[model samples]
Target: MKSVNQIAVAVAVVGISVSSGFVAAQTKAPAVKSSTATQAKSSTMLKATMADVLKASQASDWRSLNPENTLYLEMDKGRVVIELAPEFAPKNVANIKALVKEGYFDGLAMIRSHDNYVAQWGDASEKREFKTAAKKVEGEFTIKYQKDTEFTRLPDADGYAPQVGHANSFAAARDPKTQTTWLTHCYGAIGVARGNETDSGNGSSLYAVTGHAPRNLDRNITVVGRVMYGIELLSSLPRGTGALGFYEKAEERTPIKTVRLAADVPEAERSKLEVFRTNTTSFKALVEAQRNRGGDWYKFAANHIELCNVPIPVRVVK
Candidate 1:
């Protein structure tokens, strides 16, 4: 019998054809010319560090998350906040919201905690019925690329996709030839787990990536949303002993208190939070700052950064 991890890896092998133009655009290095004018310009510009950029940011640089699109996952340890990306997976998000509203995940427990992979939770016994939610949802691995979508393009080249950027506060990738855009498998990303069929998994069985960015999973699964806070609660869980990191016994699972939509929670009990706007100039400056690290602590500044390495800052409103 094949292990669950092997099956997942096998399912992720979807063929993607990269256009020649796309490859040429990303691989070509910029022409470097040593000129007196360039030297003078470089000397005059004072580069601001990421901290300095944040400190100087205006209120417009940040936006409050919509209550309707937010989720509060409560456990014995604490609450984990998640922001749903309805723009990316509308049907899946709606299904997930329905499942959440019907108290489908209240009694469920964390069944799998894979080392350097993901932490998954759901009805491990497969006994729970989908009262109001769909048993299967069409996989939304990628959506038709909309021209009006908010995509702040990252200059860095990625091996997985032709173009990588931030879309609606989520790390994303696109292929112009295919005219498709998909959310990436960055840390804290929430994905629906399935068996063999692409549409087999619904929102009932959800997992959060807690380790390295599994870019291989991109365009292979439906990424519903991402955890905005309390990722440590999932990452800190004991690694499962069984194959594919599933708990061998029911007693080993951690119980879930409830998973409620932020809008459903009372105003007094809600967590007011804000995330840095990626479409703003301040975000560009922040990215530039990170691309070239400042301060004397670093001996060498890695002038490049991976798409998943970019930090999406979030803050609690006091």
Candidate 2:
């Protein structure tokens, strides 16, 4: 089994290498230093690594995760902290929270760990009764694009959506032509798994992206949130052997200890975490640094970054 640190490095490499649309299809341009870009004008960003950008960030550049909007998936390995984006999928978030309160996922098992895809967890028998959560929920694949939406759009081009950006700290995109906005299937995204019918996903069966950015699923499924911490715990699980990566035997499955709302957990037991806000100058600088990685190792800069390639950083607070 890989340690949490190893899994993070491996997953990050997968995210950067395999995510579609991360690199442009056009012919490779001549290598240019990152200093040539307009956004690189800031000395802090000019030829500076992402670490430098983060190190120079101010306290105002980060936002704390709300206890009510956080979920902790406890397992034998460790806890996976998820930051729910109720702003994008309010109904689903509400239902999931209700299910958590009812202890719906207390003793369930992770049924699937699809290689280069997702790690899913829920009642495999499909016989569990819902105490409060609805069995079906209308998909919130896309919402009406509001002018006041908190989005930090990437200037690069994307083949999947008209405009790719980050909204409410989640990777998202919007189409002004249709006035619609939806979350993308980025690495670490938590989504509801449904059957043939769109409304079948009721937050009972949830999955987190463990591999590359499955951008093809965007708007086709409901992405409720992202892993704010401990994604490695899910991504490092052994790949399932059955179809769609479902474990064939009960013994092969990893048991889920419990799923609890951070608000419900004791204050001392909760994670002291804060996420780097997307709508900040420091984050923008970080994006630029990623677009054109600094240091002496590279001869050229990519000069382009996709929605999933740009990482959303989280830090533990003292």
* Cα-based lDDT for every prediction: 0.81, 0.83
lDDT of 1 by residue, 1-318 (tens): 234333222212211111112224555555453465344334213477665776687889888788999999899998888899998999999999999999999989999999999999999989998898999999999999778878999999999999999987788899999989989998889998987899998989999998888889999999988887777788889999999999999999999999999999999998766777889899898788767655322334577878887877765665
- Model 2 per-residue lDDT tens digits across residues 39-96: 4344433476766676687988878899999999999998989989888899999999
What TM-score would you give candidate 2 relative to the actual structure? Answer: 0.87
CA deviation > 4 Å runs, candidate 2 = 1-46
Q: In candidate 1, list every pair of residues with a backbone clash.
A: none
TM-score of 1: 0.85
Candidate 2's displacement at residue 133, Å, is 1.0
